[model samples]
Target: MKSARMLPVLVLAWALALGNILTVGIAVHAESPAAAGSLAAPESFGSISNPDQRSAAFFTELGKVLTHPRCTNCHPATDRPRQGDLRRLHEPPVSRGPDGFGLATMQCSSCHQETNFDPGRMPGHPLWHLAPAEMAWEGKTISQICAQIKDPKRNGGRSLADLIEHIGSDTLVGWAWAPGFGRQPAPGTQKEAGALVEAWVKTGAACP
Candidate 1:
């Protein structure tokens, strides 16, 4: 009699456990894509009525790419560039030489070349090198980065118009998206990032 009574309860418990697992699995599956990096389209922010607000909104979105490890690792606040997703200090302890390449003894071109070396998992581009120390983005807020970018003294003397070309057409900058295996790419496509830059500039390049 007791066993018969327990059977219904056990069945109910098993069914509830299975339902919970399925629900959790479904939720995870649905959320994973959003967790992966993405960028908002430039047109998506057009609904904002205020131009400055719209500009700032665009830049804030662009910040996702600017602040990603792929970008920041090479834009370390110090002379030493970082490497990898963890943003760890670079191995072999290389310093940015006078031209943004590493020290003469250990230049960036010493390893990085015109293309990725998948066997060694090293990323490369024909123009591989660190950003000038004046343009370092690590440890900066989006607004601070925006301000820095607008300042020619700190922005490699780039005008607002020049920024669009650099961000949109510069192959070296585009390399962030194509970093090889074992690396997380910057959010969104480079073209998308450049469109955001154009929109931001058109709307006044307001800082967030």
Candidate 2:
């Protein structure tokens, strides 16, 4: 009788031990950082021999970077530019004056200094100014922007070749990826984004 009672207790202890081992295994799997947040990583701009398909993929993925807060903030639809990740109305109610400069007395150069000044809460750039009306991306879908970009009338008369240099080496585009202090940088580094642009141009700059 004592042996029978001890057998039941032993089986229960074995089951508990198995459960603990399984729980620990699951925890180890969960805590591995590499396995977590895999979805948030940037997509690989893998090479493509097919000019058409490669061109399309490049622009499609590049769209994510271009349409981000940093690029779209200055390319707003209305005269008033938006700011921050929320894309809220520009503070202090500034407007894109006749020449894409600023309202009469409150020139963009007045507050947006040559360099970012965290003390003054100003985000700056060497040539800080609004994008031309043709480059406005606010209220535009990726498809629309892609189509417009391919049109000479809308793209500042630049050929596909021009886009490689325009996006890859342009100071303003580079600024989006490096805007300083408390500002969230754009999705990818400037060089990586520029390489993607170059690759897209080489593949013929297909619209997506």
Candidate 3:
């Protein structure tokens, strides 16, 4: 009789567990792409009336990728770039030399080969090197980075069109999406980021 009495309790427990599992599954499916680490289309910010505000909104979304470690590790505020998701000081001690490559003793290509080596856990690309010192973005506000990106001298003479091409289709920039096994990729794909740049320039390239 006691065993019979406990049977209902056991059934109730399993029913509750099944209900919770279904709820979680439904929630996951409801999540948006931007919520799942991809950029949203510029038109999604439809509530804003001003074109400049809408432009700034687009860049703000792009900022998610720009400020990410994949982009920042190479855009060090100082000469010495940092690494890892934690943005810790780079191991093996390296710095931006006169031409954005390392010194003769510690060239970037010395360890970072043409392709990432998951076995050794080193991220690489054929053209990996620091951005110019003037483009250093670590510790700067999004507004500051935006201003620098618009200036020809700071942006390496890139016209708005050139900026779109560089960020949109450049193979080196595309690497941020495929950074090695242990690293977190930037928020969205490079193509998406470039599209945002193009939209921003078309709408006045306003800064946030």
The lDDT, on a scale of 0 to 1, for candidate 2 is: 0.77
TM, every model: 0.85, 0.74, 0.83
- After the best TM-score superposition of candidate 1, give how far the Cα of residue 74 lies from its true spot, in angstroms: 0.9
lDDT string for model 1 (1-208, tens) is: 9999999999999999999999999889777533665689889987999989999999999998899899899889999999888899998899999999888899999999899997898999988999999999899999999999999999999999999999988999998888888887888889999999999999998999
Tens digit of per-residue lDDT, candidate 3, span 81-151: 88888899889999888888898889999999999999888989988899999888998889999999999
User: How high is the lDDT of residue 116 in model 3?
Assistant: 96
Of 1 and 2, the candidate ranking higher by lDDT: 1
The clash tally of candidate 2 reads 0
Is 2 or 3 the stronger prediction by TM-score?
Answer: 3
The local distance difference test score of each candidate is: 0.91, 0.77, 0.88
lDDT of candidate model 3 versus the reference: 0.88
TM-score of decoy 2:
0.74
User: In lDDT terms, which candidate is top?
Assistant: 1
